[model samples]
Target: MTTLLRNCRPMGGTAADLLIEGEVITAIGAGLPAPEGATLLDGQGMLALPAFVEGHTHLDKSRWGMGWWVNEVGPRLIDRIDTERATRRGGFDPATQSARLAREFLARGTTRIRSFADVDTEIGTAHSDALVALREALRGTMDIQVVAFPQSGLLVRPGTLELLDQALRNGADIVGGLDPSGIDRDPKGHLDAVFGLSEKHGKPLDIHLHEPGELGAFALELTIERTLALGMQGQVVLSHAFCLGDVARAPALYAALAEAGIAVATTAPPSRAVPSVRAMRAAGGRIFAGNDGIRDTWTPYNMPDMLQRAMLVGLKNEFRRDDEIAWALATVTDWAAEGCGFAAYGLAVGARADLVLVEAETVAEAVVATPPRRLVLSHGRVVARDGVLAS
Candidate 1:
């Protein structure tokens, strides 16, 4: 299939025509002639950008398609975890909810996502099974990487390690772990179990490190040590690494993480401590953003919009200037795609034809205003328009 997108400003630059053949962009230039018998669509001079990438999220836990869920869980992380487990045990269709959320993400201009599926003794690999099916179902339109996440803690919950192993063997593409020192109280044991699974299955690791201060730093050190010892450089990511917020203690850690090729993901929660985006970038550490959980039992705040998430990141990081805001936008677009390992994702020729056109004059304006996506294309096919999924 050949399609030409005409009169679009690539990253708010000069208006140009983008030629897409099959699923890759073939050419981009002003007044490019469309191939004979190819479909031509008017871009109306909208700002063009690579489709958003969700670096980290929980696909199996979203209650988006359901009615408004009242969130009354305690502030503590354990409290939220217990409440979520009870809610899941009470019964909810993971496939249905995940599909709904995935479609919503696509409609919002997100073409790729890395989602964590809960794996515990109670639920086992049920979440992973559902997510795996969803991943296959949305194979062409949306790319999803499933992580066998032990949300409830591995060592603390007996048999969870085996369950994670099973999840990876079944279809999960990544291995996940939660706070090791904070939750399991044994950082070494927790890291060993997860790193062992990653080595065994030849998968990557995306661990959630919510441990604060020195504890979080210690866990991060252990993670980096394992990454180096196992030659897993660039194969590991640390999510919600709040410890990186400590400017005083972060420089050395950031240097080490950069050397180890380890990446970081942050939701940029307003009330929580977050890593310095500029500092990490300067230190050569790759950092991205995600909308963690949306309308789940854990929290009633948050939406599936990566653009909105980028705006939040900007606000949280105090990004005032246009360049800084544009950097924040990259967290969800270029940086997020790179961090999540989305191949051939960009607005350049030979890249995948996954793009979104928004009604904005510049990237910074788009990030600040977050205007509705006027058109979205995935794999050279129009998939959405005006914030709605096209049939």
Candidate 2:
């Protein structure tokens, strides 16, 4: 497929024409003539951005409002999550909800996502199966990585180990765990199980951490040790270490993780400075943002806008110039995209033509305004045009 995108600016930079051949971008500049029989898109005054990437999402719980509505006013968000987890059933009709959310994300210019599906003995890998189907269904349209996540607990959930192994055997890319220490006082041991499974199968691991004190920091330390000790390359991710703030000596931990090449998926907001991010980034660590949970049975925060997550991180952090904020937001898109192995997710030549054109002339304005993805392209094909939401 050959296509011409004329008069487009990327991240509010110089105007250029984007020419895409097949899946890779062939050229980017103005005055580039379109090939014969090529599709032409008028990018007049639009800014092109790499497609938004959600480093973390829980697709298995994408839709759950019926039982959720009844349990309103839960004292804490996590509390609400527990309630939803307890009472929810049959909400995720994978065939319908997965396709629905895929289109929703495509329309929003998010072509890359790393979603988690809860795994356990009783569930029998049903979530993974559904997500696998969704992955194949959206193959040419979107990049979806399904993580075999143990939402309850690895040891706590009976047969979780067997089920996790089954999930990997069935084709899960990442091994996942939640509350390493909280699941069992022996945080290191629990992590060992998850990491051991990862090492045994040569898969990357992403863990969920809710404990904010020493245990949280300790869990991260153990992960770094395990990642290096096992010689696992690009095989570890720590999600939502929100309680890292409670640890008095987190800077050194952050620095070590950076040196060890450990990546973190943070849910950053202005109020939460996330000191760990500053120290980690300074130490050359990769930081990616994840939506974590959408309006599902699992979390009160159901808004699945990666742009909003970026905006929150920007507003919460103090930066010397606008570029810092732009870079931070782009991390969720560019850096996270790379982590998900989407090499062609940028505006450069040889990259995929999956790009979003926004209304703002400046990156700061674009992020703050969180405008509709003015133009969305996938595989050099225009999946969405003119910022019109798909019905």
Candidate 3:
């Protein structure tokens, strides 16, 4: 397929014409001539950007658009975990919900996602199955990466390590682990099992850490040790790493993360303080954002909109200047892509023709105003428009 997008601003830069041949962006320039029998789409001054990439999300736990399920306020993380396990014991079909959320994200200009599927004895593989089904169902329209996530713990929860191994063997793209120090109580053993599975299957790892203060910092040190020991630099990601902000050694931690090429995913948890994006960028570490779980049993908050998430990061981080806000926007776009190691990511020529058209004059204005996704394309094919799914 050949398509021409005329007068569109690339990365909030100068307006130009973009020519996409098949799945590759062929040419980009002003006054470029269209090929024979090409489909021409008027940009109408839309700012073109790479489709949002979700680094961390839980598609299996999502209850968006369902009747309200108020989360029980908990003083501890275990409280919420127990509540969620009980609430989701009798498995609900996630196929419908996953499909709906995928449509919502696509309509909002997110074409790629890395979602963690809860794989424990309690939930079994139903959640993983649902997301895998959704992946097959939405093939070509979305790029879905599934992580075999142990929601409870690696060592604390019996049979979880084996379940994670099975999940990785059964179509999951990556391996995931929970809090090493806090929940599992044995950081060494937990990481050994997690890293063992990762090495066994040659898959990457994404660990969830909610441990606070010094404990969190210690857990991160252990994570860094395992990452460096195993030589899994770019292969390891730490999600919800709120401790780097709690300690005075954030600069050193950020420097190590940059040197090791480890990534961080922050959902902008209102209660947790996250490290400065500018500082992390200066240190050369990748930082990204995601919605996590929206309207699940664990929490009643979550939106399938990455743009809204970016705005929230800006607002919660107290960003005032346009450049600061733009930095937040990159967390959901380019930075997110880089964190997830998305190779075919960009609005440049010769890149994948996966992009979104928003009704904004500049990237900063788009970040501040967050205009609706006017048009979204995946691999040169229009998939959604005006908050509606076309394909």
Candidate 4:
């Protein structure tokens, strides 16, 4: 089916009409004539942008559709992990809960997602199984990349390394690792296992690195070394590498990360130290944004809106200029798409027709205000309208 999106500003630019023919944009120009028997949808001169990309998140852990989950976990990472494991042990359906969160993300205009599914000795690859099924179910509407995440340390928890391998062999798309030094107390062992799995399965790596300061810097160096040595350059991503916020180590690490082709994913947490998006981009490094946890067992404070996530990123970076704010917008759109390996993405001719129309005059205003998504399209079909998902 051919659909004509009329009078929409591409990237907050001049008004134009987008002609989509079966999942790909065919033409983009002013006053483009609609084809015979084409469905015409008025854009109302709204800003047209690519659908949001959620580069890092925990889908299996979200309690999105459940009751208000009072977060009573302790301050440390282990506390949260223990709580999550206990909750998982108690048996809440992952596929159901994750589907709820994923649909919420879709309604908010996210068409691509890279979600971490926990893989441990206790639950084994149960989470991975559920997410792989979910990925197949949402094949046409959304692109989901499942990471076989070792939330519980690889070395600390015996047999988890084997389970991660099992997850990769079964269906997980990527190999994920946690704090090598902080959690496992064995950075070398942790990295070796994850990188080895990536090489064996020929998959990518998205490791969660929450270790701060010098400890995190050390882990970053180790990760870079492995990425280069294994020739896994662009295939590796470090999520929440808080060490990048350290001015003392950021410059060198940013340069090294750029050289190694490793991307960084930041949730832009206000309280914690975050990487300078401008500095990283200027240093030739690719940095993207994500909404880490949405009303999960860990924290109750997050939404599924990538636009709001972009606003938080802009605020965290103290971005005031329109261009600077647009850069923040890219963190959740273009940059995030590339980091998550979503090809043929964006508002351009010959790209996929995964677009979001927002009620805004400019891209910067869209990021700052995050007005309701007027309409959302996936595979050139209307998937949502007015913040509600299409049936």
Model 3 CA lDDT for position 99: 83
Off by over 4 Å in 4: none
Query: TM-scores of all models?
Result: 0.99, 0.93, 0.97, 0.99
310-351 per-residue lDDT for model 1 (tens digits)? 999999999999999998999999999888888998999999
Q: Give the clashing pairs for model 2.
A: 17-29, 212-243, 270-316, 294-302, 295-302, 344-352
Q: What does candidate 2 score on TM? A: 0.93
Per-model C-alpha lDDT, please? 0.93, 0.76, 0.86, 0.93
Q: Between candidates 2 and 4, name the one with more favorable lDDT.
A: 4
Clashes of 3: 0
Pairs clashing within candidate 1: none
Positional deviation of residue 267's Cα in model 2 after best superposition, in angstroms: 1.5
- Candidate 3 per-residue lDDT, tens place, 58-130, comes to 8777887778876665777888788778877665667787887888888999989999998888777767777
Candidate 3 residue pairs in clash (backbone atoms < 3 Å): none
Which is superior by TM-score, 1 or 3?
1
